[model samples]
Target: GQQVMQIPQYQHVQEGEDFTTYCNSSTTLSNIQWYKQRPGGHPVFLIQLVKSGEVKKQKRLTFQFGEAKKNSSLHITATQTTDVGTYFCAGEVTGGGNKLTFGTGTQLKVEL
Candidate 1:
């Protein structure tokens, strides 16, 4: 069975500090997508990486994909209260429609 693993269900950081979380899948993933869920809010799409060894950045946030497409990481350079949220990684399975399975999720807490 395929599985997605994530670490640090919760994380706290001081303002101006850095934070990072990792995601991994038991089976090789065809494509991966990252989502963010704000407190008391639903998940929102952040980014997706399809190619092996792909990397992308959004402002203070950076995302990376493993060469095997089975793992990924997200790094935030500076922590802020506005950066508080849960980051999730979803993978697309070979079979079925929109079979987007999500990771356990990394809850991020930024202190001011």
Candidate 2:
């Protein structure tokens, strides 16, 4: 079975600080999709990167596609209470019925 995991499941940061989280998998994937969930809300689509060596950013957030497509990362330049949420990366398995498998996911909290 393919496995995906993310480091620093929870992060607490002061306002205006920086934060980062990493996602990894035991097997490669065709593509990966990232989502963000508010403290008490459902996940909302963020972005998707499919090509190796690809990178995309929205405001202070950055997303990277691994060279092998087996790993990915998310970084935030400056933290704000508004950034508080859980980040997830979902990938597809080689031969699984489901097209998407999720990472452990990183939860971010920004302090005042």
Candidate 3:
């Protein structure tokens, strides 16, 4: 079974600080996906990485995939109140049935 693990399960940052979360898989992944879930809100798909060593950014957020396709990372340039949420990484293992294993998740809290 494929398992995804994330570090720094919880974070508290002052507004304007940078934040980052890492995700790793027990097996090589066919694809990696990132999601954000705000307090009292459902999870929202942020992005997906298919190619090895791929990097993508959206506004103040950056996402990266390891060359081996077994790890990924998400970084936020600046912490803001709106950025407070739990970040999750989901991965699909090679040859594994369409099931996606999600990481433990990293919770971010921004103080004004």
Candidate 4:
């Protein structure tokens, strides 16, 4: 069984400050998916990183995949209240078929 873990389980940032969360996997991953879950809501797919050393950006959010394909990170520029949520990284092991292992998650809080 593979596991994915995220650092800084909880993060508090003032509005307009930058925030980042790191995710590491126990084994090499074929792909990784990022999701955001708001309070009392279901997880919503944000994006997926497949290529090693891949980097993608959506608006003020940036995502990066490690060259080894065993780690990833998410960064947000100018944190806002709307960014409050639990961020999760799900990884699919190189030969694990369609199964995905989710990380412990990082909860982000924004304050004015």
Clashes of each: 0, 0, 0, 0
Model 3, stretches more than 4 Å misplaced?
A: none
Q: Compared with the true structure, what per-residue lDDT tens digits does model 4 show for residues 38-99? A: 99999999999999999999999999999999999999999999999999999998667799
Clashes by residue pair, model 3: none
Task: Tell me the tens digit of each residue's lDDT in model 2 across 1-112.
Answer: 8888999989999999999989998898878888899988999989988898789999999999899999999899988898999999888765666578889999998999
Model 1 TM-score on a 0 to 1 scale: 0.95
Runs with alpha carbons beyond 4 Å of true place in candidate 4: none
What is the descending TM-score order? 4, 3, 1, 2
Candidate 2 is scored at a TM of 0.93
Highest lDDT: give the candidate number: 4
Could you tell me the lDDT of residue 18 within candidate 3? 99
**TM-score, structure 3 vs. true:** 0.96
Worst 10-residue lDDT window for candidate 3 reads: 92-101
Residue pairs of candidate 4 with colliding backbone atoms: none
* Predicted structure with the largest TM-score when compared to the true one: 4
Q: Report the lDDT of model 3 for residue 97.
A: 85
Task: Give candidate 2 regions above 4 Å deviation.
Answer: 94-98
